[model samples]
Target: MARPTIYSDDIANTICEQIAEGRSLRSICLDEAMPAKSTVFAWLADSGRDDFRTKYVHAREAQADVLVDEMTDIADDGSNDWMEQKNS
Candidate 1:
């Protein structure tokens, strides 16, 4: 099936949701269910899509926060610090 080009709240929300979930727009756009990256960019560029643009920006910020949290968790975890190489 062809990807959707028409702007809709559902599609906009889906894009933002994926972004918030730490998925890249490029990757999301690759999905058959989503529009092309250029189309998404166009949506962002459109002045009339202020709501979607806001949501998209917030989603990106949220994704960054999630990445930082994951990094912090990895740094705090000491379970792997005790691992030593075994002699063959």
Candidate 2:
């Protein structure tokens, strides 16, 4: 029997939008509204849509930059302990 589809363009778009907004894909996928992480990975790697793949990659890169910025902030902040760095 065929498996139920846990993915759709609307869901994909929402994931991409979350990434664009500096959210982690893992965290986004963990939400009950989003699909499984494996499903999202399969979609990105095999969906055969250059536009969507490119957009997702770009958003991922942006999110990486945001993470680095946050790390830098935590390091520069003498007020917070090493483990006390911001959650996001």
Candidate 3:
């Protein structure tokens, strides 16, 4: 199916939700049901889309937090950082 061009509150919310869940806009746009990346960027550039832009910004901030938490978890994990040694 062709991606959506005309923006809607539902679509905007869906995009924001996924973004907050640590998904990239490029990946989200790859979905056949979502809008193209250019379309999303156009929405951001459009002055009339202040609300959507605000939501998108907040979602990105949340995504950053999620990424930081994941990084911390990975850094804290040393399960694979060492290898077992055997006596000769």
Candidate number achieving the greatest lDDT relative to the actual structure: 3
Q: How far is candidate 2 from the true structure (C-alpha RMSD, Å)?
A: 7.8
User: Model 2: per-residue lDDT, tens digit, 1-88?
Assistant: 3322455677777778889778988888777767778877777778576666887888888788888898999899889554657778
lDDT of 1 at 76: 100
Best by TM-score: 3
Segments of candidate 2 deviating more than 4 angstroms: 1-7, 81-88
Using all chains and alpha carbons, the TM-scores for the candidates as numbered come to: 0.83, 0.71, 0.91
Of 1 and 2, the candidate ahead on lDDT is 1
RMSD of each candidate relative to the true structure: 3.0, 7.8, 2.0
Score candidate 1 by TM-score against the native: 0.83
Runs in model 3 deviating more than 4 A are 83-88
By summed lDDT, the worst window of 10 consecutive residues in model 2 runs over 1-10
Model 1 pairs in collision: none
Per-residue lDDT of model 1, residues 42-78, tens digit only: 9999999999999999999999998889899999999
Q: How accurate is candidate 2 locally (lDDT)?
A: 0.76
Clashes of 1: 0
Ranking by lDDT: 3, 1, 2
